[model samples]
Target: MFIESFLILLALNFLSAGGVNRPEERIVGGGPIEIEQAPWQVSFQIRGHHICGGSIYNADTIITAAHCFFLSGAWQDPRHYEIRAGSKSIKSNGILVKVAAVKVHEYYVHKENQFFVLQNDIAVVRLSERLQFTNKVQPIPLAESNPEPGTMSFATGWGNMYGADAGDANKIPIHLQGVKLRIQSPNFCVRFHGQSKICAGDSKHTICTHDSGGPLVINRQLVGVTSGRGPNCDRPATFSSVPYHREWILNAVKSFPQHV
Candidate 1:
């Protein structure tokens, strides 16, 4: 829950983008990243196509943005999605795990007044089987405590870079990319994302289309989940505050019966 002292607004344009900026590409003003740089990073896919990015929360669970399914009008049935981990390429080699269940925040609902705002944009995905942990496949710890404003962090993903053809599957990046970003003040985020969300980077350096559901990490801890981006992938991007939903995540994972 957000502190009572804070209040907010919706940068309607950002939410109305309608999942166009998924796999929001490479960190703007950043360069190509190594395949194993962020081992916990995973690609959320439909069939064999990459739709969004997510973080490996544990051996059999993934944490990603809820809007990844809702905003894109994707089927929520576990059979319709897959997790490709331990690799950067969308089509080549990796451990492809079938999804068993997708637990979206119960309170996460889309509002339809003027802005189609999807609040509480987080979800937990349970894999059908436990994943093999390796140098290239591992889980990242969620941030136990929130970091201060202006803290440096990195966001890595295989989304579109430079907004080229943005949502075009053919134009999305195959190799992952990473860029350095700085956490923004709550006030800065309120201008674009509203409460319970945070902003990272600035006009010159920000996450873009196709990168939603990716992790924003600081000190190797998962701090944020990529939520939405400004139009054209430029300007500051909003993310679901990981620390804010930590308790819900723990309970969600604990309630799921382990699968063999």
Candidate 2:
């Protein structure tokens, strides 16, 4: 019972703070990520502050972590949301895309010991407009296959620094901070209470704070969504595995009304 037993305990211990998934790993060398002509990433505003990470899949849709605002009994309306596409600078990104709809997993439990850790953690946000691909902003290629262990990748966000002085202060990247880490599995990571659906950080350097909802990039293809920091971003990155949620993403795309 991965979700029922192991996941339950982890949710109780870590998710008690009310955010996305977490863990640690070794970072690929190069200090911080060097800016290249890469695809556009997305960020969301929660409670007047940006705490969520996401990526543009199409002109009208963005993918993010479901836990962004999914707390039992107190979740806020997902309307009035925003997404920044082109630029890497969190404060000065190019396009500020407005959201038209927010779709979360219907079976999401937000509970302990659930069998579906990969199900409810994924979400889709429909944008009110379509985007023209640009040098600094473009859609990342979707996952073509599940990442095998030891596959190296990058995760980016403006969520928070592992040691944030004040909440949301360490968030919102002054500059895009990207770290390289390899993917591990629940085989041994779950011993420390991780899920099988996530790629464990190599326990080297932590993923940066502002990286939630950001993309777990591998070989230039989008692999995972930065769901949560593993109590420390300097460790390995924990993610909501995109490979395991392909059908869910397709359904969300299909279920979206096109009237807008």
Against the true structure, whose lDDT is highest?
1
User: How does model 1 fare in lDDT?
Assistant: 0.73
Q: Kindly report which residue stretches of model 2 are placed more than 4 angstroms away from their true locations once superposed.
A: 1-37, 46-48, 71-73, 112-119, 162-172, 190-196
Task: List CA RMSD, all candidates.
Answer: 8.2, 7.6
Candidate 2 per-residue lDDT over residues 83-184, each given as its tens digit: 766765656657776778888877654543421133346788888888777776677767857788877777766544444222334333455566667677
Summarize candidate 1's per-residue lDDT along 1-260 as a digit string, tens digits: 14211110111122235433232444576777765789999988765766678999899999998877663343345566788998877777879998888889999865544433557889999999899998888899998776688898899887667663453555467888888988887667424554477778887778876677899999889999987665566767778888888999999999899875
How high is the lDDT of residue 243 in model 2? 73
Model 1 spans > 4 angstroms off = 1-26, 71-75, 112-116, 164-171, 190-195
